[model samples]
Target: MLAKAIFLDIGGIVLEINWRKTVEALGVFDRSQQDQIWSVLGSAKIHLELERGNATPQEFFAFVRSELKLSPEAPLEEAWNQLILGPLPQVDQIFDRYAGRVPLYALSNTNRPHYDYFMKQFPVMKRFDRILTSFELGHRKPDSEIYMAAATEVGLSPSEIVFIDDSPANVDAAGRLGFRSFHSVNSVSATLEILQRHFSN
Candidate 1:
């Protein structure tokens, strides 16, 4: 089957992210401070809400400051954007090769601040025809609504598009919806093989 569009996840697929980098940079100087950070911000309820676009960046920052007793020394962007590292070289080549040939889009679970920082820091991401983020769409990956919206955004049935993500849950979610999804955590060559199987190499 030929894929008319491609949906890619940003965090682990296109760029490198160290999730713990946030707590570390935000000055987790002690065990108690670390515990406080994880207990509150890392909590499923709070963190999921943040990813699902319920809380704005400022709101999350305020919650962190108030709950974690963080000083006002560091910039809020730094704390939140700490996870973002750099681009994946092979992924960049993949995008450059298939960008205009196929309609490439980003379907990521991320908040507003993270989205803005990524676009600004990695201008190459602008090549995507569209970027559907959780913050903008008010839904996260593995959700039926988001998957449907992605199909709509690409103007194709789920089977007509290919979704690549590092999360197994997300891959399974896409597969359930009949999307030609692939798990991308283990190897880039493997992902390339999946794409080649569905599209002209």
Candidate 2:
């Protein structure tokens, strides 16, 4: 079946964001203690709260800093923004390869600071037909609500959309909703291969 719309995750698929690097930069390493830092570093509920527009990045980072026992004036603000190092190397090529075939959308689970920082710093992603983030939609991935919203944004049914993400759980969630989902682990080329093999023909 051909995908009428393609929804891709940003941090890992379209952008090379080293969330761990940001956590390490904050000097938080222990797994037990890393819980607080992990929330800001990975797909945790606290991070989702920020992406859901419940808390500003400043407020989120302030909470992280307080958990780490760092001063409010500490230079960790830049660390969160630094999570987005740059765009994925194959972004332009990938988009160009599939540009007019179907509407492409950024269905990311990210917050405003990181999103705004990347939009200005990495203008290449503007090529996507739409930008749908948890911040704007007020729902995160693995939740059927977000997937349904994405399908709505694309003006297609879940089965008509191909959603790709690096996380197996997210992919599984989308698959359960009838999407042609791909677990795109660390390679855009591989992601394209999956699309071509599964959805394109």
User: Which predicted model would earn the best TM-score?
Assistant: 1
After superposition, which runs of candidate 2 have C-alpha atoms over 4 Å from their true positions? 27-36, 39-45, 198-201
Evaluated at residue 69, the lDDT of candidate 2 is 79
Q: Global lDDT for candidate 1?
A: 0.80
Q: How well does each candidate superpose onto the true structure, as a TM-score? A: 0.90, 0.88
lDDT (Cα, tens digit) per residue for candidate 2, span 1-201: 556778899978988977666776677667666666576446555667998888787787777777677887777867777667787777787788777777888898888888878888888788898999988888888888999987887789988888889889999999999998888866888878877864453
RMSD of each: 2.2, 2.5
Model 1 C-alpha lDDT per residue in residues 1-201, reported as the tens digit of each score: 567888888877888887667888876767676677677677656567778888767777877787767778766678779888867667666676787788888899988888888899997788889998877677888888898987886689998989999999999999999999898863556667777877786
Query: Local error of candidate 2 at 12, Å?
Result: 1.6
